[model samples]
Target: MEIDPDLQGSVESSHDPIPTVVAGPSGIRPSLYAASNTSASTSTTSFGIRDPWRVTPDFAPSVGSSSGRSVHRSDTWYPAVPSESRKFEILYIPDPSRAMMKKEAALNLGWTNRDITPAHFESIKHLTGLVYKTGRTKDRVKVLVTEWLWILLQMDLFENSEAFDVRFMQWQDFRAIILDPTNDIEGWNMLAKVDCIIGGIDYSVDHSGEGNSYHLNMDELARYESCVAQLASQTLFWPPIRLARQASMKWNTICHLQMIARLHGSYTPRTVRLSTGQDIPDDVVLKRSHSECAKHVILPTASRSRRTWEYLNAHTDKYEFWMAQEYVQSLDQIGEWRVFIVGGNVISVVHTYKTSDDGWKGTVTESFLTLDEIREIVEKEPTPIRPADLRRKIVNPESGAAPIRSRARDDFMGFVLTTWKHLVARETRDTGAKPSICLFCRVDVGIRIDMSGQAPPAYFVNEVERSPNTSIWLRFHDNTMGTLADTFAMVFKRWLMDIRNPYIL
Candidate 1:
C-alpha cells in the first residue's frame, strides 16, 4: 500500500534531515529533488540577503573564485535553477480556548526527548571534525558544501510545506512551551500572537544536486549552523529539526524499531544488505533506507533487485545505498494494513489492495489506503490453527497481492502503542517524562497467518512515521484535517517555548 505518498520525496531531496550514517560511499551530501524536479535549474539569485547571506541577484555564481578568500563570512549560495521566492503558507491560526497554557496540563502530551536527536547531532559534530582533520583543499570544499546544505535543508524543514506537509512542525502555536516551571497558572493569558508560517528559509532552491553544487567552499556555512543553534535557540529549543530527522528519515525510523524490537522481543523484518547484488536465498524486497512510499518500493526479486539498485544510483536525487529487507511470506494469508494514530487515539485503520498499473523497475502501483474503513483492520485475531480453506495460493505482499485484515487490527494498534511506550521509557529514563506523549505517528505493519493453523500469526512493523502523509483516500476531509491539525499542536507548543519536563509526547 502507498502508506505515505511523499515519504521518500523529502529524503530523495536534501530538504529533510539526513544523518551521515546512511550517506552511502560518496558521503557527498544529498541536495536534489526526485524525477519531477531533479534537473530544475537553481540558476538565479534574488535572495536580497544581508551580511553573511550575500545578495546575489539574477546570475549563476562563479565557483572557483570564492575558495581562498579570507573574508569574515562565506560567499553567497546560488540556486540549482532560478525559481520563485520561497513563499510561506499559514497552516493554522489557533483557537485560544482550545489551547492548554498551564505548564503541567499542557505537558500531558508526550514529546520525545534525549534520544535519537543527541546521537544525530553528535554524529554531525564527529563527521565534520573528522572530514576537516585532513585540512586538504578537497576535504575543506566537501565539508563546506555538506555543512551548508545541512543548514539550508534544516531550515527548509519548516519553510517548504509541500516537503514537510505537517502543520505543527513550524512551532509558532505552542503556548505551553513558554510556561514557567513553578507557576500554577503559567501562560494562562499567553497565546501565540503570530501565524504559523510553514516557511523557514527566506527562499526555496532546488535542494537536489543543482542546489548543493553552488555554495562557495568557505567556513561560513559551518559558522551559520552554530549561529542558529545558539542565537536561534528558541526555534531549536526542545525538538523541531531534531524530530524531523529522527522520525521522518526512514533509516532513523528503522533504527528506532530495531532497538525497540531487540529490547522487547517484538517483530520487525530481518534487515539484510542487497546493494552488492549478492545471492538471495529466498524472496527479498528493496526498501530505501531513508525514503518512503510503496510506489518507490515496487518489490524487486533477487535478480531484479540489482537492476533497481542501479537505477537509483544513476539518479542524482536518489540514494546509492538502501535496505534489502526480507519479504513476509504468506502461505495463504495476504494483504497489508496502515494503522493511523493521532493524539494517542486510533483515528482510523485502513485495508489496502493491489493495483494493476505498474511503474518502472517493476514498482507496481497498489490500491491506496482509503479513509473509509471502520473500526480495527481485522475483527478478530487468527485462530491457533489455520483454517483448511485458507490454505490456497502462496501470495507475496512484495508481489501484487491485495491486503487482508480482521481481528489483527486491534492487536497491531496495541503493538504500536506498547512499543512506543517502551521506546519513550528507554529513551527518557532520566529525562523526566511519561511515555504517553506521542501526538502523531503512523505504523505500517505486515502480518502472516499459518495455513495449517499450527502457529500464531506474525506481524512485523515495516515502517514508522511521525509526520505521516495523509493519502488522498480520505472520506472526511474537513473533520480529518481538523482532528489531524490538533494532533500535533501540543508538540509545537513545547518546542516554541522550549519546555522539557513531565515527560515524552
Candidate 2:
C-alpha cells in the first residue's frame, strides 16, 4: 500500500495491536509517556528520574524543574491504568518481569507518541534537508545512520562496540574489513552489517543497578529499534548514485577542512578557494569540529553524581564531533563575555567576531572558548580599557602547549579583536549561514535568527546544584581556570579563535 509521505512508515496503517504487555492484575494504567526521550528539551539536560504514573502534561511545570513529590510519596499507589489525562504511556512493557525497571521508560517512550507531534517530525525532516542540502550518498548516509543508531543502542544497552566486535571481528579490524576488500575474504563485513540492523535499539547490557540504567526492558526496547531498522530496510539496496553523492560530500568536507586550515595557517597549503570565495593563509589558525563547539561544559564542584569519561567514551562514535576551540588574548576584558558555570571544572564562554577588514560589520563567527587561566578572570574585577589597544601574539610558548598570560588584560583584548576579524572573514566565505546575534553573548552584533520562530521553551539558569525547576534548561559550564582578568582575556580569546560548524544531522 502507498504510505502517506508524512508517516515515516515505521508504524503501519494496520489496526493498532492491543499492547501485549498490559496492566497485569492491576488493570490498565494510562501511560502518558513518550516513545523516546529524543525530545530536544531533554537532549542537553540530565536524564533525571521520572514518575511513571505522573500525568505527562503535569510535568511541564517549567524547564529544569522536576519534583520530589514522586520521591517522598513512596507508598503512592498508581492504578494499572491511571486516568488518561494524568498518565504517561510507555511503548510496551515486559512480560510480568523486570518490575524493578525504573518507570522512566514510560516517560521516555511516551514523549515520542505524546510530545512529538506530526508537525515536529516534519520540521526535523525539513531541517535535515536544509542543513544537508543534497542528501548524503546512500552508502555514506547508511554508514552514518548506522553509526548513529549503534551509538543510541549503545546508550540503551542493546550491546556495545566490544561485544559486537568480538561476535563479528576484531574491533580494530572492523573498519579495515568494511573499507578494504583485499584484506577481507570471509565477507564478515556483510555479517557485521546484519548484526547492526537487527540490534538497532533492542540490544541490552547484562549488568544491573544504577549502571543498568542503560538497558530498557525487552518490550519497550524492541519497539524503537524496530522503528529505525525497519525504516532503513525499506530503502532500495545501495543505489549507485547514492555512492557517488557520499563520495562527493566526503570530498567536500575534506576540502572545507583544508581550505579553513590554509586561512588559519593550521596547514601548509598556501591558498584554496571555491567559486564563492578565497581562503586566508596564516600560521596560527585553528580548525575544530562541530562536536567540540556545542559541548555542554559542566563544572565539577557543582555536582557529585556524574557520567565518567569511560562511560561517554563507550559511545564515542555518537559524540566524536563534540569539541571546543581556544583563543589567547589579554586578561582584562573577561567580564564582558557571557559566562556560566556547568560544573566544578567546566566553564562555558560565548562570543562573536567581525572580519579583519571591516569593523564589527563583517560576518560574525561563533564558538565555544576554552582557556587554562579561566579561574583568575572569574574572580577578578572589570577594567575600563578598550579591547583595541591590547598587544597580539600568534605563537604560544610551544607547540601543543597551553598559553600563559604575558601582558596586561587590555593588551589581550587588542590581540583578540585582531584575530576575531580574521575568523569573521573566514566563516563568511565558508558556510554562508551566520547568526544575527551570538546566543552566548546575547549581543545583537551579528547575523541571527529569530529563536522564537523555532519556539524554544524558556531557559532557566540556576545558581545552585539542585535540578532545574523547568521542564528544560540549557546548561552552560565554564571550564577555564582563571581570575576576572584571566576571564576577560579568555573571553576575548574565544572571540578571536572560536570555530562554528553546521548542525546537519
Candidate 3:
C-alpha cells in the first residue's frame, strides 16, 4: 500500500488485508484487520507516562472501539514479523542463552552513520526487513530492525548489526534480561561491551513501598567520559555505568528557573514559584523537577497549584523538585520539537504532532523538520506579535500589573534553531563545562506564535538530553542533500573510528 501524501498516517482503503497487529489479552500480537472506521490517538505527551498498551508506532489503533478484537499500546498497529530471508536483520533476544545462540552485536554496528545513503536504502527496502519468531525456533530472533522501529534503529548504519543479536525487546522483557537476578551475567556483558546504555522511558528501579523510580544510583553513576572503554560488574551495575539519564534528571530541568536565568535570557515559558506570588492560570502545567518523564506531574483543570506545590514542599525529603510553569499554548495541536545534534551540528529536528483524518481525534506521529520548513516559520510569521489573540493573560501589559519579562526579536532564532544555539552556549559559556561530551545530543524546544506586540513569536527550551532516546532518529530529508541519513552515518562513523578525532560534539 502507499503512504498518504499528507504528514498524518491514513488508510486510503480497508479492502486489502494489511499486516497489522491487534492488542489481545497477552499484549499486541499479529491478527486480522478490524475493518472499521477507526482512527487513533496515542498517549504521547510533552510530559507524563506513555501508555505502552497503546504503543502503536505506525499509527494509533482505535483501542476504545470495545467491539474490535482489541487495541493495546499507544500506537500498536504494524508489528515485527519474521521474514523468510534476511541480510541486515534484528534479533529479538532472550536473556539466559541469548548470547550463546548468537554472536555479540558489533560495538559500531558494522557501519557508522556515514555509511547510510539513499541508494543503499532503496536497494535494502525489500532486502532488509524484520524477521521474528516466538519460541525455540532456529530463526527465532534473526529479526530485522526495520519492521517496528523508526529511522533511528533502521538507519543503514545498523546493516547486518542484528546478526549479532541486539534488538528492541519490550520494556518488560528487556527489564527482565538486564535487571533480573538470573541473567545478571549477560546483562553485565552488554554493559561492558555496548558503547552506551540508556534506559528508555520504561527503565526504572522498583521501590517496593513507593512504586518504581529512575534513581539507579544516578548521583554516583560514572560520567560518560570515564566509562568509554570498559564497563562491567556482576553486581547489578558494576565497573563504570554509562547509562544516560532522561532530560528531566539533567541540571536544567531540575533547576529550570535558574538555568534560564544563566542563559542571559529565558527562551522558555514564564516559570514562577507559587510561594513568590507567581500567577497561576486555570489551565496550568505542573512540572516534576527531579524525575524522568513527567511521572508525577499534575495537570489540573483549576488553579489549585499552590496545594500541589505545598504538598511537594512538605514532603521534600521523599519527593523530587516541582515547578509551576505557565502552559505555553501550542503552535500546532501537538507541537514539540526535538533537535538532533551530531557532533554539534543540527542534522535533524523531529516534529511530533497529533494528526487526524477526522479532525476531532488523532494519534501522535514523529517526523523531521526540514531546513526549508525551518526557514518558513520565520518567513511566514506576522511581523507584529498578536498578544491579544496569543493567550489570555491575568495582568494587562500596559499597566504592567503582573510585571512580566519577554525575549526580544534579535534574541530569538526560531524555536528549533534556538534550542541548539542556546543549549551549547549555556553548557559551555555559562556552566564553564565541556559542552555535550557525548557522541550526540537532543534538545527539545516548544514553539508558539502567541506573545505580546514586542515579541509575538516565542520559543522555549524544554530539555537538554545527552543520551537521547533512539526513537528521535526518524525519517529525515533535505532538498539539497539527496539523503541526510548518510550525513548522520558520517558523523557516527567518524566518532567510532577514533574517539580522539577531536570533533567530540
> lDDT (0-100) at residue 58 of candidate 2?
28
Candidate 3 per-residue lDDT over residues 27-114, each given as its tens digit: 2121211112222232211111132221122221111111112212433463322111122212222111112111222111211122
**Which ranges of candidate 1 are over 4 A from the true structure?**
1-231, 236-239, 274-282, 295-298, 301-309, 315-320, 329-333, 358-410, 426-437, 452-455, 468-481, 490-505
Q: What's the lDDT for all of these models?
A: 0.33, 0.23, 0.34
Query: Which tens-of-lDDT digit does each residue in 53-113 have in candidate 2?
Result: 1222222121111111111122345222211111111111111111122233222211111
RMSD of each: 23.4, 23.4, 20.9
User: Which ranges of candidate 3 are over 4 A from the true structure?
Assistant: 1-243, 254-266, 273-283, 290-319, 330-336, 350-422, 425-438, 448-455, 465-489, 500-505
**TM-score, every prediction:** 0.44, 0.19, 0.44
The lDDT, on a scale of 0 to 1, for candidate 2 is: 0.23
Per-residue lDDT of candidate 1, residues 376-458 (tens digit): 22223354333322221111122222443322233355565666555555534523332222444555556554435454556
Q: Which ten residues in a row have the lowest lDDT in candidate 1?
A: 62-71
Summing lDDT over every window of 10 consecutive residues in candidate 3, give the lowest-scoring window: 60-69
Pitting candidate 2 against candidate 3, the one with the higher TM-score is 3
Model 1, 240: alpha-carbon shift in Å? Answer: 1.3
Identify the runs in model 2 with alpha carbons over 4 angstroms from their true place: 1-227, 233-259, 263-505
